[model samples]
Target: MVTVPELEGTFIEVETLVEEADLSEGPAAVRGVLAELNISEDAFTTEQYTDAVIAHRSA
Candidate 1:
């Protein structure tokens, strides 16, 4: 499962693979998924997403 915390100024699409996969190999799988969707790590920061999530939860 992928957990993409929302950010105020950035948008990210979430996806899940139906095939069985090992959790230990999830990093590479996530990278592949991001690449497939053209997503970048620099697109959103932890602080930004944390703030967004907190604001959303409070609301």
Candidate 2:
């Protein structure tokens, strides 16, 4: 688990592995699960957790 003051609450990382031919479906599939979990698309971020942690500690 990781905690960053810049973000609210805890974060959960989800990923899907897909073949190169079906690579486009990766994001869609993850978004589908996020939707079912009531998580908004606006909350999606591509920031690395390690970077967030480093910045948080620096502050």
Every model's Cα RMSD, please?
Answer: 6.3, 2.5
Model 2 residue-pair collision total: 0
| All candidates: TM-score | 0.40, 0.77
Residue lDDT tens for model 2, 1-59: 45667755778688899999999999999999999999998888898977877777798
In model 2, the clashing pairs are none
Error of 1 at 19 (Å): 12
Residues 1-59, candidate 1: write the lDDT tens digits: 23554533545545455446565565677667777777776663445456768888898
Q: After superposition, which runs of candidate 1 have C-alpha atoms over 4 Å from their true positions?
A: 1-10, 13-22, 44-59
